[model samples]
Target: MNELSLPTSTEAAIRRVEELGEALKQNFPEYVFPVEHSLHGGMYARTIRMPAGTAAVGTLIRVPTLLIVSGHVRINSGDRVYELQGYHVLEGEINRKQMAWALEDTEITMIFATQAKTVDEAEREFTVEFEQLQNRKKEISA
Candidate 1:
């Protein structure tokens, strides 16, 4: 399978990432991840910045999203693993939870198709995932 098309929503994948996330929390300092949001036309984009050595575990995305990862990182997506750098984009992925470690300061952005006018509305639309990340820095629309 290609980078964009991966086996998702498998129970094993979500569990493995959850374990990684817990390990990261215990090993690293508390980080309030910063996110930037943008909305235009029918798309909503959310960008997150992860400093080197920090890791993040994502919630299952309810909608198909375009993922752009910039900088160096290792991503464990259940049964597969990837080490990516310098602006790579993965698309057509839905219902997946991912675990990523930033080898360098990294930025990950996910774009979704939506009619939401504000960040609040977008969260409301995709409540399942965003609720899991509510502890992060306040959502800032760009």
Candidate 2:
């Protein structure tokens, strides 16, 4: 209805999304969507490769980030469900959790403008619970 609904209730939406993510993790095998990181010219890009039909959930974004969606996917998000295709690029101030199913093999990249010199620094800059969940993800997925 309204374009990019800003989560009817931020906390409620967050809890709902996180609950779904946890349930998916508990019910299904861990689907490892390989993540690639690169830093260049005052910017950082985190690219995730997701297989078709697989689902994923993302953390809260701490800042304005650039989201580039390649291939086809349906993101049933906290605010709305976005069916995106091709190489769509948008700068978003995303503030909640994500639940996405890849319609086709997909590449989703989050680019950030950063002065940080290392990937670790850039991640800490953008992520809310870098030490808690993000690091744990790297460990589990590695």
Candidate with top TM-score is 1
- Tens-place lDDT per residue, model 2, 1-142, is 3353324227777787789888998999977677888999988999898899888877777766777889999875556788988987765665655667899999988897899998778878887766644445769768
Error of 1 at 51 (Å): 1.3
Task: For model 1, state the Cα shift of residue 123 in Å.
Answer: 2.2
lDDT of 2: 0.76
The C-alpha TM-scores of every prediction are: 0.84, 0.84
TM-score of 1: 0.84
Instruction: List model 1 lDDT by residue over 1-142, tens digit each.
Output: 3445544668877887778778877887767788788999999998889999887877777777778889999887658888998988886466788878899999998888999988878866654766567443334421
lDDT value for model 1: 0.77
RMSD to truth, every model? 3.3, 3.2
Model 1 RMSD, rounded to 1 decimal: 3.3
